[model samples]
Target chain A: MSERYLFRGNHAIAEGAMRAGCRFFAGYPITPQNEIPEYFSARMPDYGGVFLQTESEIAAINMLFGASAAGVRAMTTSSSPGISLMQEGISYSCGADLPMVIANVVRGGPGLGNIAPAQSDYFQATRGGGHGDYRTPVLAPNSVQEMFEFPKLAFELAERYRTPVIILADGLLGQMIEPLEYTFDPVDPKTLPKKDYILDGCKGRERRVIRSYDLRPGYLEKLNFERIKKYQKIEAEEVRYETDHLDDAEFVIIAYGTCSRVAKAAVRLARNNGVKMGLLRPITLWPFPKKMIEELTGKTRLFIVVEMSMGQMIEDVELVVKGKAPVRLIPHPGGGIPTAREIWERFQQFREEL
Target chain B: MRKVYHRPEGLTDTLMRYCPGCGHGIIHRIIAELLVELNIRERTVGIAPVGCSVFADEYFNCDMIQPAHGRGPAVATGLKRANPDLIVFSYQGDGDLAAIGTAEIVHAAARNENFTVIFVNNAIYGMTGGQLAPTTLPNMVSTTTPRGRNTKLAGNPIRVCELLNSLDGPVYINRTSVHTPQWVLKTKKAIKRGFEIQMAKKGFALIEVLSMCPTNWRMSPIESSRWIEEVMSKYYELKLFRDLTKEEK
Candidate 1:
């Protein structure tokens, strides 16, 4: 058995990235996520990694673009407003097909809403946040253990796809403390496969150019089509989610990240109270559990979607359900998190109406 | 027959797309020649900015990356810090360096990043039609400045070398023009010095080259050179603003 330690979500993310062979990190300080940069500043040098407190989120993301193009695993973390500043660079990374990881410890938003936990960036994260014909795979982690384990998986997926990956967490998940165990052995970067498209130099070979624009008549169109096929393959192969009591579930609760923790509790509370409620927590938000939801639609009576937003992921669930089952939203928008009692009470009322 | 002059091996066979009499071709040739002379072509990484030289990745025979507009310095910082052995350079224009990317360049210099910056100041935006640039001279008319540039409303032009000279981080800061053959040689020397300082791991260095934009200036190639000599040079002085090498010696 591996050793277990009590760690905060933010510090676990930093340690996880270090063990995953992340050699470069550049980020600016922001609310709720400041611990990530602080942890990296204290520990990254000991790991023989580069740590840069960039001037702004824009510079941090662009720095990741450069470092990743030079063939190293790089990452950055920010909150919502800062992540907004990084959209341009993120779009450029997608266009250039460079691999890197970004973590957004979400907070209330529209504009500087608050530093409390919220999931208002679902549309922004699932849909490409920047101006481009592209999509970034998003991982939603609910626990400190998932936070500790997700970076390695995120880096692997990023390199495997040659695309940016986002770890979408909230302020609550980042600040909470929990005990976790290291699931995988530490990875040595030297043992990793060599990247052929890196821009180290043109020593004894043809020169390489990493660029995003093709101004030719039909070149950009062809590039977009190729990228679409890659995204399609990802959609088919990479959908991840966790289901609890789905075998005999009459009422299904669909959620992700911090909201799903409350949802899982509500499911157990309903089961003890002699109700048949189930939970489906989507781990990958972009390659959503569409097929499973569609399959569940035939047997379920009602799909209750719980979120900390006005209702972002519900649109995806509803799209897949396609009116086959009745879909309802339990929203706790803008810094408010639902409790197990509150969710169970809401479910009781909905079931009475049904 | 002995080869009196030939193309530098650092440049590819691709034909350049710069306009007639534009100074980008001249500057590109100078950089290419120096890359061959320094024998760092095999280990050099060049950053192309978002301007008329956006296609520079195709022209330079080295590993290149074209990042967002004005983000060349930040990208170079990443590349150089990640792999210190790679000689990195950021090639940018007036709009790219002074207008959109001011924060990145300022912070890179403040950190004393060991990289070279090739700043081509032509006093007007070239790629996006002829708009007034941060370096546009007083009373110089551009597409945006239908009337002569009013210092009251638009503010005076920025002298980049003077501004950066105020900061102690930069090791070498020079401003040279390419209007005449003699001045072109001087500009080449300044660029070589910038790269040499970076190779020695000294600190940040920038060579600001005063270039001609004849199509935007509404002048003939000969007239543009004369205007740079007479008008543009008076406001943005042609001189070395700082040099730490001399201090060390």
Candidate 2:
């Protein structure tokens, strides 16, 4: 009764960030993710926050690094190419363990990959972008409600892991409106833990420093190993996925982000027709739910992977399946949201093959 | 007080990860000294770049935040906007500044962001090993430029300060070099001035330091420095494109 609000996914992200103590925002306008910066820019200052339209996605991400290093919550949003521009900054944030949120309303890519609803950035976001061995925690939100709720989770994840967290949505999820709830206590930026690494102003205090460079070859190697250890722990602890109708199904449809919504709709369509297909939706991409996928391999021989990309996450599903099951990709890039009929047809083709 | 030229106390006690003769070290040291002298060492925040300067935060004694490559300007913009009292700067390289990040640099400067940019321009890429850069001069040979940089084929290297000067944003823009002791001193002065202007809230300040890549250039460090003076300067002439101290009407 107490936790309801009417909001769009993008607005929810802005609200969540504000609730989570994010006081700065810098972003270049892009499809799907534009509303996020638009909301913050228009309303942030009214709430004692600062909003800026950065020169580029590259600028927005670097701005996030600046604000986050100052020990405040900050974020930026963009689609495909914009996200590519942000890879370098994302790597730096990962290297430095800076806490910030990056939202990628992915569209198709390679060049200015179309801006329709596509999920082509899976490889870029989950893989170690930029250079070096570093990974940020990537979350795939399936609904407008999840969209609003995930920013706070992202901030917490970023602070807990001392790294960046990405909210990987697509055009559909970003554009859609939904009912959501605000669950957290009112945030006071003044009471947040003091960041020993923040660069305040040089008026007082001893010099403070932050960096990912370890010149000693051995030490660099050790530091990299330690970072990997942290990633491993995160993979183990942060892997989140949802299983619906998993108990009574011969075919389990695997998807994430927006495609999973299509998959959810397809599950209902297939069930009404007596085909009976369950769904497995992964929320976390980097610490991918490999264990869950591995376990699901025994329950189903045919698994359908729908994505906006050509076949990146499907590759992850295959890796865990280890040839134990059949995995296929229903790719729609450039923000193309597939219809329930298309998914149903794909399921028919898979069933025919079986 | 002692000069303490080795490094700054706020700077990380890390050695150079840059390849031999990389100009990033020179630029980093100059900025480090400026930060130290300005006594903003404690309150300063730096956004490190991609390419060779990704480790910039490591060498600086101030609070460093390594941003996604090319995203330094954006991050620094956020930091500066969030806390107008904080001193924020972005140390970016040619590849990071003029290539994929061109829009970012232009827009940040265009917006008259209250920060400084230490842009290190080496005609060839350094960190990922020699490749053609945005600042690569005509007839320059690099990994991607097998038969020298052809302006007709690969496009002319952008003169950042000149290009930015054409805009209405930046309050200070100086293009210098670190190829010689005199130039290094000049570069340091330019850096200090940029920081000084930022402290005074003049506007966006940029110090484009003509740098060198010895290993990538297939030349000795000394020769590379000389090349910067003899060849690169001919293409990217040293000039102060904007002077914030002059009080624009």
Candidate achieving the largest lDDT: 1
User: Candidates' TM-scores?
Assistant: 0.99, 0.80
Output the TM-score of candidate 1: 0.99
Candidate 2 residue-wise lDDT, A87-175, digit = tens: 87788777777888888887667797676777788888888677889888899998877887788889889888889888888877777
Candidate 2 per-residue C-alpha lDDT over B154-199 given as tens digits, one digit per residue, 9 for 90 to 100: 9998988999999988989999998888999999999999999899
- What Cα-based lDDT does every candidate model obtain? 0.94, 0.82
Q: Which CAPRI quality tier does the interface of model 1 achieve?
A: high
lDDT of 2 at B213: 86
> lDDT score, residue A54, model 1?
98
Candidate 1 TM-score on chain B: 0.98
In the range B1-249, model 1's lDDT, one tens digit per residue, is 899987788899999988898999999999999999998999999999999999999999999999999999999989999889999999999999998999999899888999999999999999989999999999999999989799998888988889888887999999998999999999999999999999999989999999999999999999999999999999999999999988999
